[model samples]
Target: MKKATIKDVAKEAGVSISTVSNALNNSPLVSEDTKNRIIQIAENIKYVPNMNGKMLKARKSMTVGVFSSSVSGHYFYILVDSVFKELRRRGFGLNIVINKDKRALLSNVLSKNFDGIIVFDNERVGEHEVELIVQNQIKTVFLDRDLNGADVSSVLFDSYKSGYDLTKYLIHLGHKRIYFIEGEENTYDNLERKRGYTTALKEIGVEIKEEYFFKGMFEESYAYNDVISRFRLGNSQIPDAIVAANDYSAIGCIKAFSRLGYRVPEDISVVGFDDIEVARYFTPTLTTVRNPIARQGIRAVEILMDMMNNDMPGVSEHLAGEIIYRDSAKAKVL
Candidate 1:
């Protein structure tokens, strides 16, 4: 005898493939009697549940998940778009889950509903959850963060380099009164970019002022409120330059500055990170660094597919981005 298969079981049970699958997975759709009948028929055919034939048939789901820590995906829209297209091309389904509850996120992954997952949210995920992911043999690719294990891959953007280049360019333009708008407190990208900015400033022998550092959550509202609070409290003389964490915050800073009777590249030069679509057309044409969202998305999906198909161990990739200079930032000639 060659071997018994799901086809053999299905043939004996006189049921569809989906029906057999549902019965094997214990789906509620199948009534108790039908479920017992299928199991009895399968057993009669010598089809053990743990046999390689049965296990392999039930292993794959052909679905991948993309989870993010942020409430919204606006900042990383390009990445999500690329991932969506790539997944479609590869005949895989994409599930985007946003971070709202930690337990829910872990449970979803552990449930093995997806063949693989590309995680962008790690803030709420704990070590135990990661261990469970490893134990369950879940395929994962993390963005801008690392989970050290054989089962996890990491794809990190070169935020540090981009931030360094952007800040150094502003410094070269003779801007010293630089007000740096930083992003979220716990994010890896935020910390790396801030380090790059501070490093560039230190190399120039500029005394870093505490007041020049504005803590932000990489949001328009945070940037806007920072400006309002500073202006209301007085002594809020316009800085020579404003380096926002990203384009959204940069745009918000521009709006606030306009209402405060300030002009871009005139009174205070503004620079943004992440070359979003509107950055080039915005008033004064914002100068910013290139954010390689599309590239990251494509590469992440590629790695995930490899892992899913070839049983490859997790790997890491670090990509670099460059600065895009336009008219927003002006030289503050001393």
Candidate 2:
């Protein structure tokens, strides 16, 4: 079987190639009846248009690219889902590429295959690449880092405020000996949250102890092992409360404490950030911060569209997170 093209559609519909092309492109020069008839013939012949050719003609791909390192966690899942839905609603296609290679990622961004791009991987997109993107005038919206300049915008979570509020809430609950399970080192969100936690503790005149910090790497298993191993070494001095980087880490800490014959919110209080779906259903119902994951995606697309269509200048927006009190954390027993 032969593949049908615009010429084939024109021949089958008894119209010229230009007429067929105009009809397919929805040009007003073609009448509605002729356009419908040509479209029907094209569909009947199973004609597939060349997207690259069409993009070249129109000088627009009508697609947006999302670049990220990994879309493994619940946060990313919700964010991508929202972004796809919003793009579809706006009559745009989505292209997602997950690559840890900086060179490859930069190459894709410079290819100009997409009308705009949304970035999530901070490590892959460094200062030099960002400068190149600006120089090329490639419209981009960054979700992980706050960056605002020509042809670039950013949508970020107010992690610092969320962290400070959570810490202050725990202090209000009379928790003094507090511990923190840190996420990936040097990541924007992780660093901001840690800064907030430390600043709150400092304001209260609480001495920051290095031993109180544990490595979670934003993984449940890592947090679980870190907590369990520390306690297994006969370290009897347990903190009054523990704060995890995210909900998964918080749940891991809870599990570890449970296995050690400790009850959450009773023997020790635990709190986390990012109110993931399972947070509400967990045994102790995570006391966590509700990050606006979906909102961030929606805003990123909106900003990118504006930049691509209206040549709008880059803008920075920060969404706030609210602490949801649950069964996992409570006041200390004085």
Clashes of each: 0, 0
Candidate 2: minimum summed lDDT over ten consecutive residues — where? 50-59
- Taken over the whole model, the C-alpha lDDT of each candidate is 0.78, 0.87
List the lowest-lDDT window of 10 residues for candidate 1: 48-57
Best by TM-score: 2
**Residue 10 lDDT in candidate 1:** 86
Candidate 1 lDDT at 20 equals 80
Q: What is the lDDT of residue 318 in candidate 1?
A: 81
Best by lDDT: 2
Model 2, TM vs. native = 0.81
* Model 2 lDDT tens row, 1-334: 9877889999998999999888766678999899889877976786755433223224378899999889888888999999999999999999999988664676677777888899988787877667667766778999888899878999999999988999999999999888999999878888888989998899999999888899999999999999999997776588999888988889999999999889998989999999998999999888999988999999999999888778789999999999898899888888
Looking at model 2, residue 136 earns an lDDT score of 65
